[model samples]
Target: MITQQRKLVTELPGPISKSLAQRRVAAVSSAVSGGSDIYVAGAEGAILLDVDGNQIIDFGSGIGVTSVGHSDPRVVAAVTEQAASFGHTCFMVNPYENYIELCEKIAEVTPGDFDKRSVLLNSGAEAVENAVKIARAYTGRQAVVVFDHAYHGRTNLTMAMTAKVSPYKDGFGPFAPEIYRVGMAYPYRWPTGPENCAEEAFADFVGQVHIQVGEQHVAAVVLEPIQGEGGFIVPAPGFLAKLVEWCHANGVVFIADEVQSGFCRTGAWFAVEHEGIVPDLITTAKALGGGLPIAAVTGRAEIMNAPVPGGLGGTFGGNPLSCAAALAAIETMEAEDLPGKARRIGEVLSARLTALATQFPQIGEVRGRGAMMAIEIIVPDGSKAPDAALTKAVVAACIRRGVAMLSCGSFGNVIRMLPPLVSDISLIEDAMDVLAEAFAEVLG
Candidate 1:
């Protein structure tokens, strides 16, 4: 087993990793990018073992996919057992108990006391696409509403829904039509102020939907309960609830894209719980299948069943192995109380990040729930301009020092930390130590 501690045997992107990078440049497309140059050989808990025999502490959690930690024993056992039995019978062709059981579990755990139904998919983009399909089918409407800085997925339709242009949307033109963009209640960057952001943004959002899209033609209003890639930006209080109420009143199916903030990453089964809002449709992925690939759209049975049979499914929508892993992962989350664990992790992270903010004015803000947290980097010149270069420098420095981190946000100025829920507090502290050193070195 790999030790859950940082160990530097060689410089990052050491000889072996450098050689692999050369090979990768020859074999792989230049379009594909990665967060680090270090090639990973193995991972366990919150530590990744690079090909050069270095143990780097993980702060990104594979962009929040390994909430249960890498290769969790329970998930591994379940997948192994299921794979040995049968790999892919195609749940659509020959139904299996695991698929049915996993859906049952999803219905049980996802928010809502109503009779819920779920359709499993292969990725978060697929789930969002299906959610829109179901909502349109149910409401007989066409327009879909999304917010600024939202990241639905990478598919064509999802690209239309996403806010960023340079990486996700550039040159991917002629996107799906009838996708309306709205302003989010981003408290930190709100012009008026955080105190007035909720009400004002809500009004602007509703006004835009009413005037631009016509509420009657809206099929669904999709949003991340807490925007993830958008700098982990938590909207002002009452913002989400107000939107939910408006969607309900306007006959729009509210879809909560909990793809990044779902499972135990946000201290709740879903981040919408924090706002006490139960959406009509919720899309989930990332941490859902442990480290395996599985996504789901679980919601009101009436809405979910609106799509005719054979309308919503794919060849590998709910693979048997993925279902087994999801079941075991959910079981582990319940058994280990990962949600509570996430809250504790949040306390530690919030304290440390707040301290860092006090020390470095370049840290414009630190925000997020549970284990999902981030620090926005900015110029200390009082203009609050995004400092993407500084952010990149800090993250690269940390990675070089045996701590893996990731930078996100519209401006690419947010250092997002998503450590595994099972990571030790001491491990987190050590990683924070590295982060502080990097910040000091870069800012000085």
Candidate 2:
């Protein structure tokens, strides 16, 4: 509970954590890996307390799942009250009021003023899978289009939809069929340069959809407005709007996969709102449940109702406890205006990272919006080659210094920061200070 500031009572992964790591190796699955060796005993705000009494600054936010902060009191109270009353009745069999209320809240918060309906699920991938199903059912098509360097989820269909291959999709295939991949307007690594990225990428996407995958046969075009697992790649201006326009013309559902970019993480209700575009369907999860497992697919009622009464849902979909936590999280976000908070966090991240980039040529580019930001690491050579080794070293240095950071990207050369929105200016500055020291130690 004492997490207002950072403290290091012991070295990283001291005795307690080491023992736990050994126990974990014996008990837990090998597939479940962690960013650090330190075992969390407790967490609050932006600080994670290790079992050895080391208080580390949290910059990852459990991979963007705790935007409201770890163990938020309001969320805890709501979940506790709901759990004491009753944990699960299986909403599909015996519907609950909290589930319905959560759906209403999601409809109000997500984009599009049109009549919308929602189906709650357990994770981002489930939400996306359901969205694809709905789109296909409604459009009477089978092709689902995704962009390069995109990371949807770990499910079979989502793995097929994802672009990265190493850990996510290496030996997992043969994946689902009829999934089309297109080039994203990645501004930093555009072959022709940032100036021509939007138009060229758009043209290429149109050509691919037409020539390779017929636009008429496509069910949905799904993309993250600001690519999350793709090194926080913010596409060139107007890229997403053009895609939305094309989807409209072709009758393809434009699905915004806001699992990581939604819930005030991008300084807006959803990242797509930054461009004033309304997606026909939106898939959201991560922070939506306030550290609980809950995801939802919200969209126009006509599209959402494409599936029959028993066609969509899981045994645990929209569990009462997760619904309570989601409702409380939404209330906290609205009451505190967390979107404004996220904008301020973005300003801090931009200022700190921009200054760091000026100091280190290895910092290829600093990009992202609001609490979700990242720095792509590259070799100092003019070719701008990704330096995955150097990125790993930098992240290791940060962890050794009691700051938890994350590495992501197709090539593993990007350091992303997803600090909790509730972290105050002082805590954020402290985390950035540690980051600055880490960069100086690694890049200098």
Candidate 3:
């Protein structure tokens, strides 16, 4: 059932999927959203098999969750072995060795040479909220600063920190207060052009912090090194490093929300590594457990310990099975040099996407590092206006042609590609070909 080749024997969203969709409409809440109509029966490597037996190539990686790949053998084996031994027994009530070992691994792999500590949680939102809690506790500051086009998580506090409003925040208010958003060094959309983005953006961020929210009251300045949902917006070079220096000077805790760009997705263990900057706190999730739900806030020992003994914990924070899966995932990432693998994947994406951009003027930009990349679709008249409709059309064509795709960006014009790091060379080529063909069909 876990076939690597993409084979479409029937129409996409074929009979079985159509029936399942009808059932889902009847049984599931409209709030629980879905992007594609094809219901997956099984997935392996870069291929997803739908209930209708159509094989589709997956480029989204479940929005960057399945980095190692769906049903990775190492992850499956570890999870199974751990479940057979014991599945639950809260880490708070009864400590587990696996949980401690996982924390150790977190400290070892994360950036920063100083002693670090971690607290595990069930989701990225929880880890982000906990990071805020830790920073607030440590600095005794009430104000939190986040950048524009940054997405922390979906929790109430994180929703407040998030920059976008339509789907993630639309009816969900009154959000947590005392959270402030400032400018980001988005090169592609810089008003004064990308040349001045680094200096201008950083100055604007600092000025806003001092004018709108005093630096002394700021607990933490959180950001995604490479903005994910807002678009694969890699900041102008030296921007983050400069920001980090300012945060250090102002005694503001710098938190890197690596929820989407961590764990070898960005050609490095963490995206911040590219700029040679070390964050005071780093939140990680998505790829940590290979395919399981797990997240952690790893940071300086002094800051992470600021929270009281009982302040941080959940019923299933670090479940035994998730811990086992994480250990195996980390081992697999290391043994296979997934960071190196991500670089090679980036090369393939860069060559193909750049070629597509040259052909299709609608592709305003192609950005992102490693397996995490995106094409910003725009109008062809050189106005640089976001062409969200064209983006949707291209993505729909990909889905119909037996390839899974996803789109993101505050304006909804970025088609993001987050293929599994374990994807074979042939699979990457095939997926890119399908995407290019989709663009030609839609744009031409």
Candidate 3, residues 279-358: lDDT per residue as tens digits? 99999988998889999999999999999889999999999999999999999899989899999999999999999888
Q: How much is 11 displaced in model 2, in angstroms?
A: 0.8
Give the alpha carbon lDDT tens digit for every residue of 180-239 in model 2: 999999999999999999999999999999999998899999999988887888989999
lDDT (C-alpha, whole model) for all candidates: 0.93, 0.92, 0.92
- How many clashes in each structure? 0, 0, 0
Per-candidate TM vs. native? Answer: 0.99, 0.99, 0.99
Q: Poorest 10 consecutive residues of model 2 by lDDT?
A: 1-10
Worst 10 residues of 1 by lDDT: 28-37
Candidates ranked by lDDT: 1, 2, 3
Q: In model 3, where is the ten-residue run with the lowest total lDDT?
A: 1-10
Give the poorly placed runs of model 2, Cα more than 4 Å off.
none
Model 3 CA RMSD to the hidden true structure, in angstroms:
0.9
Greater-TM-score candidate between 1 and 2:
1
